[model samples]
Target: MSAQITLNARNLSRRLGRREVIRNISLQLKRGEVLGLLGPNGAGKSTTMQLLSGVLIPHAGQIEICGINLAQEPGRAKACIGYLPEHPPLYRDMRVDDFLLYAAKLHGVARSGLAEALAIAKSRCGLEDTGRKIIGTLSKGYQQRVGIAQAIIHNPDVVILDEPTVGLDPSQIRDIRALIRELGNAHSVILSTHLLGEVENICDRVEIMQRGQLIYGDTSVRMQSLGHQAGFIVTLQSPPEPAELYKVPGVVNVEALSATRFKILHSIDANTAEALLSLSAQQGWQAQQLTPLQGNLEDAFVHITQKQPNQHDQT
Candidate 1:
């Protein structure tokens, strides 16, 4: 956790016609951190990203990139960010290299630095071989890499990806996840997606939003802890009388499933658990499994999002 803040939004708000799309929101992303933006559909995730990338001017808030105020110094601040929207902006007819060159030129890369710049971007995105291929000819996965290449060609301090793996296959998704992890090691990344697994796999921290408000924001580990309700399930080799198990002091509940298996839910600490195991061992009932169920990121997401009832009268 470095002291440098790559992106910060304070009291951010936006409106679409008469409807408020984003409310008072404050967020910050540290340098070299991957912050996952999570929400259900129409949760203002896209609008937030657009505002940060300078595509949409915020209604009433401040966006700062690497200490530069976006409102006051749009060019200097925006130059430090690379944004990939849900639909990547691509020139289908242009060759990959040509398109990248055009992007580089637009970003003001010097003529002498173009070759090395293209190579770095290509290598990082695994597009070295596809540089000469027409953008439309490549597969979706390759096209995505090209999109990323354009985003990072200028080596921006912050990279924002919106559903970077939306249309890729499972294998392609894995590859993109790896790329996102690698990107975070060098530059701060704000990964926006509704896919819970994507946040679990790559993001160090996550910010869950609902109805334009940030409901949860913390490290993945911390979020998991909030959802953890420690419990264990045990199966025995020999049928155990449910009533007998329930008699144990710390036994919270007992469920008998079949002739040889039952689950004993314990309501005690580790010491009490050991005693129960020993008792099971002496009774000649083979305890098949005793594993603690830890809290996970997915559980936290469900817990937070489900509580916010949708107010949309949208038909």
Candidate 2:
């Protein structure tokens, strides 16, 4: 069976003051999946998050949370969502336990269910030991944990976190990422951040925005595979002339990198590896390494976001 979709936004557009900030953005999140919203500063990633979480209504488009239309029934739609903004809604003077209880009440957790909800939220967020501590006295990491705990206090179906690890150190970031991964097992997560590494480590799928437009969206595996499909690096015990390698089917260009190593560029639909291996056997060229050039997420992000909108559409 297919996974259930917990959040959906279609043709979402938003404008701030006189400038259009989001343009025809559309995305979906499935239960048990983590979807990262990535973009540079001012790319509208945060804006998109606000739209999805019902914090900011869209100028044009529709949003649904667990099949409830956000525009038509905002309270019901929002009841299914938990949101943690970039700056967590934390009150420094309040005790962790008190703040969480307040949050639980605000989310409409029934009086009868508050105790159980608080316990579950605290346990899931690793706050079982710090409930008595004041929020201001805790480390940045713990503060973030408390922030997350409150968001999930009501056990919403979708969790939206915007820059959840912004000020965290390396260790804290790792812990938070692990927590996010764990959250994905039970909730659809939308992580909005400019940090590429965060997306690579925590997201099952990624959507990249540029100047308020979605430039690319795909599963993390497929996005990374795009680089390998573009070219290959071949090493042979006895080098063949570049022209001979280029003669292989679908091979567009071949460049000799060293005495025995060559780089081959190929057409999009070509299986360069298979063709090269066959040619190596036929020509008696002993193959040492036949590796596809794999592209990292950073490279893919740069290449896609750097293109002009019109140019991108043409390709």
Candidate 3:
């Protein structure tokens, strides 16, 4: 791995009994970058995260963490990585302070720096005032904060979170996402999620995992542009014939929803809205409602996943 790269995995494959759940997953995470591992349920995202975090050994391939070969030096490599599995490894009976202190110690935070480590983790996760609270007594959101706190307690170079926002409410999800973004400022973070909004909002780049294969990898902005729906919906009070609407520049297709409403489709690179409005005004047709249609990330995600074949255990 290069000095700038926090994690590098080549052709990682893993098998659970007779099923090969992960296959040829080559991935790289640069320092201070947030990468989202996006896939549908049963897409092997959690399995892949386990492989990358050293929680499970790959059946094939190699992994490097901060230039240290994980297979050769698991301790040294894992020392630079912080991982929070899909179910956070939390002891419900422990107090917030106690659990975090234990986590820091497990990660080998020096005894001398343990206090500061716990304090920093708590502070970063917005858990400063919940130190004395019992882990089980806290709400779901606070428990999740504690989960994230433990992951970063040792201040590792890489932080891997599997479905961090899985069951949180809207408010909790927002808060957790903000914290993850903050972590990306200092450490390489890999977030595994099935939520498209999480990727669009939290990730810098996205790897679409399907059938244990990375079918697509790119910046979130580019990934979002995969399926482009270029068009506008307009409602005109006095509409002309469908042929008249077709005569508008850049207007390739027009669908009449009713006597007044229309769904106008244009070329991907066309500027039809302005021209359509102008034409409607000039023709004395009153335009009531005009709504621009945008290509949804959900549509793009489905499009990409459906186009790919099952890649696991193909040999």
Candidate 4:
């Protein structure tokens, strides 16, 4: 693989006992990019995360982390990865500093560099003042920070986080997201989430999985733009009946908001918009305003996934 690619997987597939939970998933994470693994619950997102983090082996396909083949050189490849699972692994009884120290050593940090590594991890996660305190005594937000600190203590080339902010309050979610954005400034990040907001706020690119298969992949901006293809909204000074509006070509549904305003839904064709403009001008329905609706992520997600075959036998 190229040096700029921190992670590269080719045709990865894995089965749990008798059922195939992941199928032919290939993805890449470039240096300094944040990638989102987006899907609904039970869509095999977490399983894919586990496979990418080297916690579970793929039955078919090659994984290269920092150019080292995971199957041939696991130690070197795993050393280049830092992963935070959906559930944060913590020994609540241990003090914050003690837990992180153990984590750094476990990741193979040398004795001479352990102190520096610990300091940097603590600082990055904003845990400088919580070191002396017991981990269990800290709030959920701080505990999550501790979890992140452990992952990045060794400064891995790629960071993988699964549902990192599943249960935090709004403020805590904001803080964690900010920390994640800061991490993306330097490290390649893969975040698995069912939450659309997390994908919108943190991801540069997105790959959507459903029914053990990848359904869509693209830049976040383009994925979001899919929802806008439905139609536009308009306001007229003298509105016509719903039946009259429906008579226009390509117009599918017209939802009246007020006497003069309506939301328009139509087929994916520019002719629909042109017909509306021409009709409005001819009828002297003084077109007061016409605006496109902001795209809906859920709509785009559903639209992309609706065609997949039903294969819910495995999760």
Candidate 5:
């Protein structure tokens, strides 16, 4: 069975002041999937999040939330989305319980259901015991938890988080990451951040934006494949000339790093280790170490964003 699509955007474009900030970006989010929006500063990641959450109207585009058209029925469409901006909307003077109760009401939760909604939000955000505490008295990490609590208070079908871990310490970042992973189990999540490592750790799929446009969008599996296909590092007791190693089947190119170390570039279908071992025995080049060189998300990000627009789209 196909997964249910909770959020969809097509031809989304936006102009801030005199310059166009986002151009013709299209994306989809399915139920239970965590989609990461990655880019450098001024890449329009924040603007895209605002558009998707109905916080900013697009100059030209269509947004649907849980099948409701945002332009035609903004109230219904926004009802299905929970948004936490870079600086979360929180009332520092109010108690955690009071703030969440207000947020629940603002989202249209009936008076009768407010208690249940508040409980659920607090429990999910690890704020259950701190309900009576003032928002200002909470630590930065707890404050972030409160921010997330308010967003999910209404139990929306989709959640959009912008730079959720910014200004956080190492421990706080780990805690928040765990919460984000937990949120993905029940709702479609859109995470926007300039941090590439976060995307590598938490996202199932990633879309890279560059100079106001989406340059690449693919599953994490496909992104990792880019790195794995780069090549392998092989060490031998007796290093042969680069040409000798290139003679092996499936070997594309060889660069000698030292008398005993060489970098071997090979086809994706090549069993590089097995071929190297077989050839080494025959040539008296005792193999010492043969390891696949893994590629990282940073490499893929650089490769996509550094290219010109006319070069590629949606790889």
Candidate 6:
């Protein structure tokens, strides 16, 4: 992909009362990409979305959408972006189609194009099946779909969704996730949610925030760039000195799960089975099996979030 970025924020900060909710945050999302905004509750996920959507002006910083400065050209910037908050803002008594028509008109959809815009939005979001249903009678998933439809009714270039899959059933969640994937193929998207699996599944990049500060922001591939740390699960035929195993070269740590079972940790990868066999033959050690443990994104998430750190005082 080109270096051209669609959304950029510099040193963004937002204050709620005396407390700063978002602190010196900066990130970028490219055209036709999906970025997951992940953080713990109160970690500024919602606050950051408001800043991006122009719902709340930042106390400090600059935001640009598709080369338009949001602060300098609010109208033009907002016209190119769509936002759906956690809760769908809907007239409960209005029919789905009627509500979409109202939303289209409010978005400056031309009178001549309202019908086309409404139909497109509904079809894109799978709301066509529920077009005549009253908003109040619709299920939570359908309501959320309506919210997304309204957001995209204007056909903005960028779409921001806050907790789009919250409270959804398994099928509904799958549907929404598929829809988000489809949307990301066409428009730049920012998805703010606590769902790590959803992020891992769909986001090209992710930004993790903690205590109002951005602790990590990186592409999925870049996040997995941590140097290899190897692990082996060993089943012993007989027990050896666990303490002595730690003294072996390349063996960083050893955790004994049982008198006959242990795990080996190393910062380097080598012929683990060869080492085990040689040691067993030399020391009369009984080694039945050894297997490598593959690493994955959950490992990266834990490492980045410091959820359960293996070491202390890491920067």
lDDT of 3 by residue, 138-239 (tens): 988888899999999999999999999988999999999999999999899999999999999989999999878888999988887787678889999998
Q: Candidate 5's residue-wise lDDT over 165-268, tens digit each?
A: 99899988988888898899899999998888898889999998888899888987688666465578888988777778888888888888888888888888
State the lDDT of candidate 2 residue by residue for 1-315, as single tens digits: 999999989999998888999999999889999999988999998889889989899999999899999999998888888999888999999999999999988888899999999999999888999999999999999999999998899999999999999999999899899999999999999999888788889899999888898988998877766544478888999877777887888888888889898888899898778988988888889998977777788777776777656686798
TM-score of each: 0.91, 0.84, 0.91, 0.90, 0.89, 0.83
Backbone clash pairs for candidate 1 read none
- Residue pairs clashing, model 6: 237-286
- RMSD to truth, every model: 3.1, 3.1, 2.8, 2.9, 2.8, 3.9
Which regions of candidate 1 fall more than 4 Å away from where they truly are? 256-272, 310-315
How well does model 3 score by local distance difference test?
0.91
Task: Report the error of model 6 at residue 34, Å.
Answer: 0.8
Candidate 1: residue 24 Cα off by (Å)? 1.2
State the lDDT at 73 in candidate 3: 97
Best first by TM-score, ranked? 1, 3, 4, 5, 2, 6
Model 2 lDDT-worst window of ten = 221-230
Whole-model lDDT values for every prediction: 0.86, 0.89, 0.91, 0.89, 0.88, 0.85
lDDT comparing candidate 6 with the true structure: 0.85
Pick the winner on lDDT between candidates 1 and 4: 4
- Looking at candidate 6, the ten consecutive residues that score lowest on lDDT are 306-315
Which residue pairs of candidate 4 clash?
none
Q: For candidate 1, lDDT tens digit of each residue in 72-158?
A: 998888889998988888999999999999988777788999999999999999997998899999999999999999999988999
Predicted candidate 5, C-alpha RMSD: 2.8
What candidate 3 gets wrong by more than 4 Å, as runs, is 1-3, 235-237, 249-252, 256-261, 269-271, 274-278, 286-291, 310-315
Off by over 4 Å in 4: 1-3, 247-249, 271-284, 310-315
